[model samples]
Target: MIMFEDLFQSTTSVSLLVVLVLLVLQFFYSSFSSKQQREPPGPKPFPLLGNLFQLDLKRLDICLLNLSKTHGSVFTIYLGPKKVVVLAGYKTVKQALVSHAEEFGERDITPLFHDINKGNGILFTNGDRWKEMRRFALSTLRDFGMGKSLTEERIIEECHHLIKSFEQNEGKAFNNSQTLTYAASNIISGIMFGRRFEYTDPVFQAMVERDRELIHLMGSASAQIYNMLPWLGPFIKNWKTMMKNIKENNEELKCIIADLKESLNPEMCRCFIDAFLMHKLKLEESEIKDSQYHEENLVNSVMNLFAAGTDTTANTLQWSLLYMAKYPHVQDQVQEELIRVIGSRQVRVEDRKYLPYTDAAIHEAQRFANIVPVISSHRMSQDVIFQGYFIKKGTSVFVLLSSVLYDESEWESPHTFNPSHFLDKEGRFIRRDAFLPFSAGRRVCLGESLARMELFLFFTSLLQRFRFTAPPGVTEDELDLTPVPGLIFSPPPHELCAVSRH
Candidate 1:
């Protein structure tokens, strides 16, 4: 009986000890939670999940806007264990990106970008490498006819092909995305390889498909997960697969670069690649620092140009057509302006000067679409104080460009699709400081001039030849201006008929 009593007592003692240890662990966890939960006044976060539960990935922009209203312009949210500071509203974003430009000059690569860019490409690189690439690219683009006659001529030829494709559509309801894609891709092709691909070319189609797939992958939950937990990539296997696909695309680009190099006549440099090769040769001859002009950098730069230039311009064109279909009055005004300027003949870049109203409408379309919803990530090179906050060195920052473009303070009708935003009292085109579709600062888009030219010429030419309208039962209000959720915001799929105005 005494032994039984002792055993019971011992078991009771062990149970008490276990409970005590659990209580201590709870206390520590509570302390850690207090530290993490102190993140700048946001909506209540779940214990382990943070605010991820509150977010709807499909309607990300709307969700962010709502959160911003509640949390104010600058607030912190957690994606897994990392603290992400979201800057909403134009004032806050401007202060971070423009007012404190030097402090926020670097880019945060994230695990996925790091894997894809390999820390070598200009978009991903920092410090000396970025400076070197930026200088080279600017010079190369200038030499290759950016804002020059040669570039404008190439654009004119591409615009003619696009017009032909539209004519072939026979005034039927069709998705103009493919035609726009063909035209935009060809522009990049001309710049990169000194050649243009036919719309029906299989190889060109493959490249576009690959690019689209990669872009689509960027916004996937898998991408976010991989970025937060990079160590889990090999174990997950799917991340590896995605990486492999990206590598294959890079390899394909390299092969094209190689072929171009083999066929190049050093005496007559025609394209961007030729110019780069010449510059590289000169560097080697002078025995200067040769890290900047490597073959990989050249190929990646060409790839960057294609990737950045193609989809953005194509997407904007698609949106412009949709808007025209939705608002016939606006379309008529644009067409009238074009007719007044060019009179149903081939339009040139020079003709934009005469078509002020048409130009304003084009600018307004870009403003309404606001394709690049968020600015690219930038990082602080050193510890800097921004608006009383001690932003640490190496901290990643982003400017919510959508906030600026759609700022109520800046635009009279921030939400509406109004061309009056770009027109003065005299009905002449006027530029606005807030109209930063290509973004601003040192890392502003390299293809800005080319993009503007394409948008103007293509839009004017299309309006001159056709009047876009939605098919039966489709209302103007039914047109979806809501952008697809991604790193780059694209309009959701829709179709419109291009009735012949010629």
Candidate 2:
């Protein structure tokens, strides 16, 4: 009977200890719950996956925008394990990016940006490195003729080549991909290498193709899946090819930079490379071990320039063509304006003032195309309590640009292709504060000025010479304005007949 009593007592003590432990855990969990309730509201996340299953892999921007309707302008969403605070609409995004620029100044180095950049270039770097590199690049680009007559001349020259390339198609339909991409690249190439490649250059063509592939991969469903399910990489081996292509391109660009170095003259400053080399040589004596003006930066900067300078302008130009083909009346009106204003003076940048209708059309095209769907996520440099919600330091913030670009409140015809968005009652060109195609704030596009010049010149010049029309058997209605998404949303691939307007 004593033995039986001891067994019961021991079992009772074990059960009591278990109950106490549960009580303690419940207390801590409740405290944790109380704290989290203070954080920005979001859809309930599941264990491990967080909100990964909730987000649409393909239409991420749309998903977030829709979520904003329910959760308000500021809300948290788990992008895999990472907690991302999405800021929607013009007021919210602008306030965070422009008004509170310093607070939201850092770039989020996600696994994708992490693998691609590996802590190099002005695009991904932060702190002093980013500042120094950006300053140098801006100064250097200006010196090499961004927003100036010299730069305008280069673009005009490229326009002539692009026109000739179109003329070669003999008014028949052919994809503008090769011609437009190559021509757009030459504008930047003229700065980076002091020369341009032929339209048929196989090596340069491959590079552009590889670059496109990478952009698509990063924006692909597979890439997002990899982000959430990285452990399954062995099963999805196709992604490895994307990585391989990146490595190969990097090496090729390095070789190009190395060759540029061999012929670089500090005194003359022939191109961006020459100018960088001169600065690099000067830096050889300085003991600043963390200097931004090194070979890695120089190479990555050029790569960034190529990626931004080439792809963006080219893709937008492609969008321009697609829109023009889709809306022939709009195209005709733009062509008429070009003929009336420019009249064959090589369509100089100075002519922009006299060509308000043409200018308005171009601006409308950029807005309607809206290639930059999502702005790069910015990071918090320090813990910030914005809009009565706490955001920890180093957290990623996605500025949903589509919310602003396509906002019903800001644009009179946000969804439709309407040039009058930038025109008054007089059909005179006017700039809208909401027309933030290049974005705003301190991190405004590095190539904004240059891109503007290129778009105007490339677009107007093409329209000035060629009356682009849908090929036979294809109706204007058939030419869709729907953008096939990429790093930038590219227009669906289709061809237009570039009939010479002689």
Clashing residue pairs found in predicted model 1: 106-379
lDDT of 1 at 38: 40
**Candidate 2 residue spans exceeding 4 A from truth:** 1-37, 229-235, 286-289
The per-model lDDT (C-alpha) reads: 0.76, 0.81
lDDT at 179, model 2: 87
Candidate 1 C-alpha lDDT tens digits along 1-502: 0123443467666875675566456545643664643434556655445567887754556677777788887765655544556677777876666776777767787888788777675777788877887788778778778887888888889888988888887988888888898899898789888899999998888888677667666766666766765655765455666677777778888888888789888889888888888888888999887458888788777777788888889988989898888878898888877777679687887877888888888998898888877653666777765554555576556566787788888899999889999989999889988888887766778789988988887788788878898876788888777778666777788888888875
Which candidate comes out best when scored by TM-score? 2
Give the CA lDDT, 0 to 100, for residue 434 in model 1.
Answer: 88
State the lDDT at 488 in candidate 1: 71
lDDT of model number 2: 0.81
Q: Specify the highest-lDDT model's number.
A: 2
lDDT of 1: 0.76
Q: Which ten residues in a row have the lowest lDDT in candidate 2?
A: 1-10
